[model samples]
Target chain A: MSIFVDENTKVIVQGLTGGQGKFHGLRNRDYGTKIVGGVTPGKGGTDVDGIPVFNTVKEAVEATGATASFVSVPPKFAADAIMEAAAGGIKFIVCITEGIPAHDEAIVFNRLVEEFPGVRLLGPNCPGIISPGKCNIGITSGDIALAGGPVGIVSRSGTLTYQALHELSQQGIGQTTCVGIGGDPVPGTNFIDCLAAFEADPETKAVMMIGEIGGSEEERAAEWIKHNMTKPVVSYVAGVTAPPGRKMGHAGAIISGSKGTAQAKMDALREAGVHVCLNPTEAGQKMVEIVKAL
Target chain B: MDLFEYQGKQYFSRFGIAVSPGDVADTVEEAVAVAERVGYPVVVKAQVKVGGRGKAGGVKLADNIDEVRLHAGNILGLDIKGHVVHRLWIERSSDIAKEYYASFTLDRPNKMHLGMLSAQGGVEIEVVAEENPDAIAFLSIDPVRGLDLGTARRWVADAELDEVAREQTAELLVKLYDCYTTGDCDLAEINPLILTPDNKVHALDAKVTLDENASFRHPEWEEFRATETEDPREKMAKEKGLNYIGLDGTVGIIANGAGLAMSTLDVVNQVGGSAANFLDIGGGANADVMASALEVINSDPKVKVIFVNIFGGITRVDEVAKGVLEALKRVTISSPIVLRLDGTNAVEGRAILAPHLNEKLITEPTMLDAARRAVAFANA
Candidate 1:
């Protein structure tokens, strides 16, 4: 009962001939994702070690009947690739390209909402999703994730997502799906979207969310959970000591005028009956405790 | 990136939005020159990005050449919140019949552009929101359809601006929306969108934040790049293409991603230590990237120990281990290094680092263990 993708989900790579695209695409394929096709505009008809490459997403989707897309194009062209996927009727998209202009993301995100209401885009700078042994997408290492467990994970940061997965795997707990919504100012998917999905899934008994400073998304998620969530949720918000106005690496990870502080986010989550941890290590332990009681 | 007042005005003007006539001056003499050209009864405003500049005496109205020289001399070389005023924006002062607030920013939750307008201006919007929430009228505009004049007119009327000021404010708001969207701005604000006695509406102040991600399309933004006063360590890291932010601490930290790097800082503080900087190698932790990061950290004299934390996802642990070794070979460090490598191919990565373990180089089993060791080294 995994969400988004399972063993049967057919996936295609947008820039499958490029270095990151080819490497991670084959990794996803080798991890048992039914990678049906690949797309490279000029390199259409060519193949990457047998995965068919087409010039457009429309051709790949039609020929392979692929429902999901992994956009690995560079930042400048990433928005176009995502729109192309939407145009071709791909339902779920995971964009792993980082450094995309925020304005492009805003336009593309709204376009998806107005024009392609059915399309779900994950990230422009995310680690992708993995439903344990069932399916793996994006760049998340398939080794650290265990299959078919009670926990569902979501995060904004890539390595923290890996760190959380590693922590959970070490605790001998598996997950239903681990979604990285990316750490961009304007991501296609957010914590709320993933949270709602996790809540609706019967297999996910508990949820663990990893958030950081910048934006009101985490605060909004807290409000939503207070009203809607039934299962126990444990969370971690990074950048506790981050100074104001300083961007801590990721583009969206900045503390702005009195809002988007780690303290504010943590307080909101705690108020929502979430077991907010002080650190990632503590978050894993808290999740383990919740799962044990469950 | 936050634009200086003068730069924001220039950006606003590009989108056909009306703003106070202004010019940036680097020196007091230059300020006087700009004020003379812009005309008397001019305002000399500090170009620092920080707020409270007006309270800090960084803003002054001068009616004549003597007052201009006096105000410019005082404002120049003044420190407002640690930002030394290296420049000033001299503008011709405008008569304010009424003050209003207007801005366009992304509403993250709704995934649309949010426009906030209030008849109550020159004060923080939060104060307006808390004091009289109804005083501010909110408009959500889809980036696709954008804002129209009719919508802007209704929005201004809803915001309860003076009847005389509504039409001009509406027109300017539409232009401001253009500046926000087409100008590639994360935030385009005109705090105190002044309505003059003549019923002319113009931005008295500008608070614009350019989306740095949009730099690829707008090569003209290269001009803003020259205005930054960056920390030397951060400047060095930026050149090497590593995600780095300089901090004041003893433990030098390097991690694989932004979140982990920040978490590393938290863990270090929890273990009774502080991080000197935040450095994210960001998936491509090759020899060159690692060596540059190491060099940047080593340049910080406060750093006593280095902590390299990598949890491989697409980044292979073995590749990271080799990169650390290669980086060590390239940059001679005065401080000990604590390494914690995990995730994909971790066993191979551990084996690769085994031969290099010594007094100067150490490996811990977990993130907490590595943080403790690094903190201990710093205290030692």
Candidate 2:
């Protein structure tokens, strides 16, 4: 029922010996995700809490047949890790690493698109994706999510994405898949990719997209939804009170000139026939109403 | 990390891009000395990071040392768009034959390096893109392939640069592109890239925003810190590893993520209380991060109520609850704190803080209710 990941998906962790990688890697494994192997470059022939560790993604993939990779390397080497995963024949890569340079992301993104056509990347600074009751691939807490749902979620923000899940689950709503596209200027997956996936997934009855200030991503997604989406869509673009040129915590969540404002995004989404809310709580309530009707 | 005009010129020169001879000065005497060195007909430009400097009288043409002294003294204390001009860029001014524009920035939608070149420069590129779309030549260069001299020449021709200027402009564009990529700049811009009366090409003005993320690779970026806007609250928060933006408001906000932090600020404003700052503790709201956040917020005299809104996912609420308690123990908070904790381990989290619930340390189950209480406290 999930768009990208399910119970059948096998995952590998890059930089599994590192603190963040070990913490999230074991956590996801405990959540019933098939975290089969880990890669830590020279930490080969060892096991991190029962998950086999290999020296390279290529070796991890060859041994464990890991279809997806969870990247938790440092920012400087993040792009190289992603490319390594792509080269290792991993179809899906979820990079949880933050602070990757935009140029590096741009170069890697283009290369991935051109050379690794089969690979699907989630983030360079994202919370990663979760398929409720099936498999948890990234760092999102599994407890907040409910299994077997009529909704799919996509978000640009980390805590906001969790908030959406918590709100839905609080209202006794379950989700099919939740994607955090990351707030970086250059994200591997965008709103349109998630929206299109949700549209095609029969299990996903509705979509809740959470966007923030910065970049023309939300507006572009609204345009794509206007022409493409068939399912009911509810959205909340954060940072209405955000002033221009102020980097609002997130690297990508800043209003540049008159572009990427919360107001502009909301206006565009509303114009696209999506129910746009001023705040996240209202957006969740609106989604609940839409889901109840469905 | 927006570089001042002189700094931008220096950065451009690092990459072999031709910019006018310029030097930065903090005092009128220093400005006159730089003008003397750079020669007469110098531009005494205020080094504030804002637009409309000319309209604000921050930019003045000085033909002699006395004029430089007068203009520099007047411009130093000038306020342009809330930025006080504390420094001036004294440069030998070029006689402009034609003004053009060129820049390289990330194309968010296309996921490529976007090169914008316009025949019409010396104006906001957005204005040119809106009023005369055809006048601006947009080039989407793949980051892997990058911009080459051949493509830059073609791009300049497409932008319809003057025949005499195209060759030098193209070569300059290639150098600027290098400064953009290899030099680790977010934006390498030359507004009114001037074609000199002598048929030479050089950047008349520069607007460079260095990529902060790339700072790890460039230890040399520490030199750029001299021009940074000094906000003590922001400086402290940054030192403590917090993502913070100081605002002029009563409610000091702390959240787990940027989106949530911004929303918290908006909610505070909506509840009739303004936000004093936007602080994000990022993924993990551990004891250290929480303590630093509270310390920073407490240091702000304008903050009446510190609103910590945490919707924990990867960051467990129980851990956050413990962190908040630990932080409160470490930092003496002057303002009343209103905390809204939810999501993973929320029940246990609230239970963890059950003993400390009081008038000063308050907890609300939802964000709205907490915001209202915080705003009420701020108003009170």
Best by TM-score: 2
Cα lDDT for residue B251, candidate 2: 92
Candidate 2 residues lying further than 4 Å off, grouped into runs, are none
Q: For candidate 2, lDDT tens digit of each residue in B1-380?
A: 88888888888898998888889899999998899888999999988778899999998999998899889989998889889999998899899889999999998889989999999998899989889999999999999999899999999999999999999999998899999999888899999899988999999899999889899998878988855886899999888888888989989999988889988988887779999988888887999999999999999999899999999887889999999999888988888888999988889999999999888999997898999999999999
Runs in model 1 deviating more than 4 A are A292-294
- Looking at model 1, the pairs that clash are none
Q: What is the interface RMSD of each candidate, in Å?
A: 1.2, 0.9
Q: Enumerate the candidates' DockQ scores in order.
A: 0.79, 0.84
In candidate 2, the residue pairs with backbone N, CA or C atoms under 3 Å apart (3 or more residues apart, or in different chains) clash, namely none
Instruction: Provide the clashing-pair count of each candidate structure.
Output: 0, 0
**What interface RMSD, in Å and to 1 decimal, does model 1 have?**
1.2
Q: What would the per-residue lDDT of candidate 1 be over residues B1-380, giving only the tens digit for each residue? A: 88988889998898888988879898888988999899989999998988899999999999999999999999999999999999999999998889999999988777789999999999988889999999999999888889999999999989989999999889898899988988888899999899999989899999999888788888999998888888989888888888888899999999989999999999999889999998888888888888998899999999999999999877888998899899888899999999999898889999999998999999998999999999999998
Model 2: how far residue B357 lies from native, Å = 2.1
**Whole-model lDDT, candidate 1?**
0.91
**Residue-level lDDT tens digits of model 1 in A1-294:** 888888899999999999999999999999989998999999999999899999999999999999999999998999899999999989999999988977788889989988999899999899899998878889998999988789999999989999999899999989999999999988888888889999999999999999999999999999999999998999999999888898887889988778899999999999999999988888999998888888
